[model samples]
Target: MSDTQFLAGPALRRLRRREGLTQAAMAARIGVSPSYLNLIERNQRPLTARLVVSLAEQFDFDPRSLRQDEAVGGVEGLRRRLSDERFADLGIDRDEIAEWLAAAPQAALAFARLYDAAGQGQAATPAAIDPMDLARREIERWRNHFADLDIAAEELAEELRLSNPDITAALTDRLRQKHQISVRILPVDVMPDALRRLDLHARQLQLSEMLDPASRAFNIAVQLALLEQRDAIAGIANGAQFSAGQQGGQGAQRAAWRLFRRHLAGYFAAAVLMPYGRFMRACEATGYDFTILQRRFNVGFEQLAHRLTTLQRVGQRGLPFFMARIDRAGQFSKRYAGASGTLMLETEATCPLWVAHAAFDHAGRICTQVVSLEETPGSPQRWFTIARTVEGSGGNGGGAADAARFVVVLGVEAGQGAALAAARGVDLSASGAVAIGMGCARCPQADCRQRSLPPRGKTLVFDERARGLTPFEFQR
Candidate 1:
């Protein structure tokens, strides 16, 4: 077990209740006293490695369940919501918020939704909610892992014998044989609007000629998912608790549901391309070498990185990673927190000091950085981040091609950094780490030369007599 403390009282209580065992009965089964188990269940004491292993062995539960649950809602999300100017007078600390989250996660999630609604200046009606935000919330709710999809994809992968070298041919053959859909690669001039198009009348799946091998295979897998995994995807999407109060724009709600279903299909596609069991074993063997994994799996950097976040299978878990994709202007296009409790994705704009921004300077090269975030006073959260630029699917067309370049960043807790091949020999210490914040608008670092905006809820101090390193100086 890792040295990190597992203070998950709610998870333990939930597991105990699910198993229908009292505290004393659970304690006796796990060889611990009822008082000790009570302390663990109340977050007063951390679960030791022995207790975790014992519980897993006795109850057949995943040991990871002993950690704080990030699936329902994270403390970071609540912290970000509380950091708004509206809640400044409340003066709630991080510890207090964490305790509240651990005690009642559903209530905390409801509070976050209410805060979001207040920020939007309206109630969170189905019509009023942003489809993208709703999709993001659903993704975060499940921690980006769909067990049913994973299992189904894994079975499909084995049935298709995806271990072969020519995955595109295999997928193409599957479509041709099973679905009677002929796979055709059309030139860009022939199919100018979209990368992949299905001509239902002709029973054909047409893909753009511009697509690379990896992309071609992915598109085919996506089509396969649409054809086969519709039931599974629909079941999950329908299970989502989307807001229905004051619903007039049913179109927007349907769009949001479709968007979430599309995301699930894409997830299933990735899982089919990279089977969970094989991918997890390879990750451990390679220490998560992105280059090696990409080559072996025949996937793009973004695809490989995205697949890494979904390795949360019970009893066969891989490292919990958080990922974000951003453009040159620092706008977040995608964000996923697969149990990596980093607050980097809370905002659209991230810290200028992060290595992700610098990735644009050195295109196609993997840039690594260890950064420290002072989310709470005197207790900094450290993360090891990897950033690389990936060419967009849009065919190379002058400045338009340059505009399509996006930087994909993958991050893990600094303690887990040593296990990654990318972070080997790099300094993971606090002194050597770059200091960044959630974003410039929320960051409190006053001395940073790259600071673009002053911290929230602070009085600005324009000192002409003695200028500071940053242009925006605020009263600390």
Candidate 2:
């Protein structure tokens, strides 16, 4: 494709505007220059491989977005184009071409334009659609389903603690004794045919066809419940609150309930493995150390952190706390809480200052940091928060079993330990309690270098004379 035909100039411009970045700001992020970026955006340049990766990381833009060609301008064909007959006589060395791609993007774009139009001015074929976007949507469906299952899981977790002490092992055993079935993973190609039995035997047991691994695990887990712990599982799901669609109609709500039920079964399994009272006692004894808990209980960090939030029940509640798990790039993997007052609706995605980022830095190191937050009086109700980062391993070989670094955070009212630790006199300054933005919009503290947008429910007052320590202006 010709350079002009494929270069997605409009979308690139829009993304820059949305991020509130000028060409110079973008250049600083990707280590380029204003004039160079300008030339590229104006269809005078083509993108390079290294720059493509840089753009993806810096702006958090999807890699697929740039590859759209018609949307962000593809530059992969630049090298071949530069090696064309038009350039052969020009004596442009490959080293010079590579250097221009990295150092002088403007010149590279100029070359791309000449080459793109040289051969019949045809445009390159558009890239395939992003699987991650679809994956994200699917993931969201699963998440909302889990959210709906929260109340049920909480109850089952509690019930299993009181009654069926070893749910996971017990369930695993039951499946073995009754059905004569062995657990095994089959490849995707054969999975659909391998588990071809969706046949239900009197509601006590059933098989599902063509289920994904996660979905299959859930179906089997649920069947295990019906076969062995029917009374308890039913009691939990039946008694838990169901919002409209969760009553089993078609849509996201019903999906959430099903996911929730499946998740509840797992929670029951975990609770069976590490009963609540026992786990809570271990936590207190170890000063909330994750590794010690993991070793003591034979559970993973993600499981341990998740179980921590579920430690709330009548007469058995631990200190009320919120829990979130984030990776090195600030991707939140899990969020859960039994706290009544804390707002825990995926808030981690909005707050980057929380120590979660630092957790991915150095593996196996626990960092205890303080956070300072303020409640808002605006329409949506917001908070300004400060957090600390701790690092850990993601297991080995970078697999699911790999030791993953994770961050845990709790909402501190005025007097919470983590909160007080961040107060002016509590002495957490050595722990790096720098102020940061919250959820993009809800953050109230201004003068923040991290401010992506004006704080919600507050007016933006630009101050040229006396800038607050943060970066933006704030009002009472």
Candidate 3:
């Protein structure tokens, strides 16, 4: 019935402490009981409008300062960060997070800083969150399709007489036969800042000696990928039909080219390391247990997941999955979807309720949820989602906090959800489907209590006479 809220408790307590007044004195000034003031100070009660007006009139405390400081103190950002599944087991609630954010904004922000520092990886920055940010949109655009590249890689492997596990040997032979380039592992110091570099004039490829066996092998495989799929990658890049502002210029063209090249190179590298046939069999046998596959191939979880998304070779297709990777802040650094709809997000996360954040809670554990998103008009996109939180090897002496942490989500569609039942150890779809929208600003669902803001087409009407539970009600 009232627009008044109890958000300013932290600020009020601070003011009382600063003024050296007891709760009784403060309550007398604000025309409230000492017991009620205790609840207000402890955030048990809200800073009422009447109390605020009385404080302004009696104690001369600025009402504007109380509102500004209180609003700024809420831990909405931290809540979003904690939604990462690594911290899922903590069982933190909104109230606790809000108290932390309000009582010590600096400490809360410092933790955020620590999180971002630790989560430094191939993450898309906040600038990429803007809908019209072309370079980022170009990058995300190229992320979806490795289907074409998968075919090309398979063809190249056949041409080079290659097979898996003995990838280094295959790479060496392929290099010599196809490109006449020799592979060498040079000292890390000699390689400068690069892990792998091509000395084309010398007709040689050099890999940094500092890399372990798996990484060293991957370097060669990536070079082979570049050599094998260069033409296809180039075609995809140049053929991408961007709009007038993003495409007509040489700079945008070059950016698009880089995006495709990187995507294809990664795809080809994964293909070479984990050949499609072998990888598919592994997935089928294990029911997509990534842990077993990761060890069998000696590849990272990210690599395993990326390879899975590329399992779209026409006759030999795996699940049509939507893979999204995000950093600690829940910003979508990379996202790829196969066969069906696309998740064109304005932010890395649409709501705190999304399991992308929950991945941080359980840390090393796998978390699954059955969610439905109405991205399309009539057809709702359902995902029996699987997510895992990945942590960087806390090697070196930098301590555990220095290790980068991120989450990877792989979502399989309707019929596909049943296939992962073996790996999940239960019926994933048994949870039924939790209804969701694309985003608060972009989504059309009007009745969602989880919406942080109203949809773009609607406006909040301010009524001086009445207040409802929600901030706004739509007319359209």
lDDT of the candidates, in the order given:
0.82, 0.47, 0.65
Question: How close to the true structure is residue 16 of candidate 3, measured as C-alpha lDDT?
Answer: 87
Cα-based TM-score, every candidate: 0.81, 0.47, 0.59
Arranged by TM-score with the best first, the candidates are: 1, 3, 2
Residue pairs with colliding backbones in model 1 are none
**Global CA lDDT computed for model 2:** 0.47
Judging by TM-score against the true structure, name the best candidate: 1
Tens-digit lDDT track for model 1 on 1-476? 66556677887899999999999999999998999999988889987777777778898777755544454356766765665644554667788998898776656766765565543435556546677766776787787899999999989888888445477788888999999999999988998878999999999999998788899899999999999999989999998755433454455557779989999999999998899999998999999999999998899999998988888888998899999899989998888887776656876678888999999999889999999987554467999999999878854524353448889999999989999999989999888799998788777777888887787788899877998788888887
Q: Model 2: residues >4 Å from true position, as ranges?
A: 1-174, 184-226, 244-250, 327-333, 344-348, 377-437, 462-476
For model 1, where is the 10-residue window of minimal lDDT?
Answer: 394-403
Model 3, position 62, has a per-residue lDDT of 69
Give candidate 3's error at residue 285 in angstroms: 2.4
- Best lDDT goes to which candidate? 1
Whichever of 1 and 2 has more lDDT, that candidate is 1
- Per-residue lDDT tens digits for candidate 2, residues 1-476, read 23233343444665788899988998788877888778767656766666766777777777555433211122323433443322333555445544445443545555544433232132321221222222222232222223323444445556544544454444444566676654444443544334423334432233333333333444455555445565555554554332221112224334444555555666654554456667767766665555677677665554555566566655655545556656666666555434423343324344666555655554544554455443212212222222333333212223344334455554433344432223434444324445444465656565566666665556567767786665556573
**Candidate 3 weakest ten by summed lDDT:** 120-129
Total clashing pairs in model 1: 0
- Residue-wise lDDT of candidate 3 within 306-417, one digit each (tens)? 7777676768878877787877676776676544334424344555567777888877777877777754343456677778886543222233665567888787775577
